[model samples]
Target: MPIHERSLIRPENLVTHENLVIDGVDVSGHWSTFITSRTVTDYNEAMEEEISALPGGEHINRCWQCGSCTNACTVNAINPEFNPRYWIYLIRLGMEEELLRDKEILWQCVSCNKCTYACPRDVVPEAVMKATAHWMELKGHTPKSPSTHFDESFTGSVIATGKIEEGQVMRSFFKKTGQPLNQPWLIALVRGLVLKFPITLLMRLGLSALIRPRTSGWGRTQAALNDYVSEVEARNSKALGLDGKGKH
Candidate 1:
């Protein structure tokens, strides 16, 4: 099919003549802007298969360009550049270079489930976004995004203790993201919580920092989960043509 979205075409691939005459008619500036035709020879034919191997990407091949995902996307409302439908089309076609154009904002998915609910084919576009972001990080196409860092921190805490303390998760996320924990909004939130529930707040903070709450007799369960996660990682890496060490 034709390019799914005009935004997907890079600016460099579009040519605009400052001055032009077409059949004695002036068609300069914006009127003269036209997409430059070029052959794509660097297709990563396995790109779609690799992404499909990741969690949430399994249903990517089911998408049928209904545009429901883009229409229902929360991020798309704020930034039209974040088009899930277009990205899915690119992935299905193995247009790796075109998909990389929006790599920086790919991880901004809010996971509101709007796209998932609206999808007619059970495409689960939300999961595809996560899988795409993970693929980018794994392939070294992009660094670990802040959202990825936050997810890893939260997941790590849960895997370690079979539970997560909100305070600890937040602290770990901020630290891993290299963000200051003393922001004004955070301070205000803490102040309000302390003012209303001083003892509760203190207990939570103390327990999270010092006591470290954990599930009782979780050793065996934790070990099992660790092994399962490691197995999944290895399988995903193999599917993506990566070495075991590159598993995320």
Candidate 2:
């Protein structure tokens, strides 16, 4: 079966016998594979509400299993396991355990907005993925993902200077993620760019590195943004039933 069409039944719940005979009927090998029945009694009833409390999760309740989000998802094209539709269903049903099966890759959404555009109900699967990822980190289900670190680094630079400095953002992300600056692909990319357009690339890089980009007279804007961010954080924390003082 295609990954998207695969049954939700857990593999461990499947029972198979090499040979079996019951009442003049022969059931062996392939025919013997049967799924064992099970009950799910540990649903987290607050799952939907808690997820909805997060910034990107607001529209999650509007999903209707239309599959448009998953169909339009760029990440899902590469990895069918990253099905936004399925995750939405699981979330709405409070199947927290089932949802966690794909937790590690939840932050892989590229925010292409294709899912958002294709959704008839404005489900905004891209935002939903972001919210679910944030929810995972906030609830301590997983450590902060590298993507989250990159986002923080990028956003911090933007908020601090009212503009993004690519070199700074890259360095900060690498430092926060404990990654080496000399990765093979990165080296190749830089080499290719320099070889193709040495003078232009060199001047641009030199100038950008020498003088960091910043918005003029951005202090007031930064202060206002900081205040708005703090207010939003407090509201998110309260919605999740957490102390407003918790670290974001």
Against the true structure, whose lDDT is highest?
1
Q: For residues 1-248, could you state the per-residue lDDT of candidate 1 as single tens digits?
A: 23456676777887778888899988787755778889998888999999999999999999999999999999999999999999999999989998998999999999999999999999899999999999999999999999998898988988899898887888889889899868899899888989999998887778769878899898998999999988888887888888746445
TM-score of 2: 0.87
- Give TM-scores for every candidate, taking all chains together and pairing residue i with residue i: 0.86, 0.87
Q: Which stretches of candidate 1 lie over 4 Å from their true place?
A: 1-35, 244-248
RMSD in angstroms, all models? 3.8, 3.2
lDDT of candidate model 2 versus the reference: 0.87
Clashing residue pairs found in predicted model 2: none
Pairs that clash in candidate 1: none
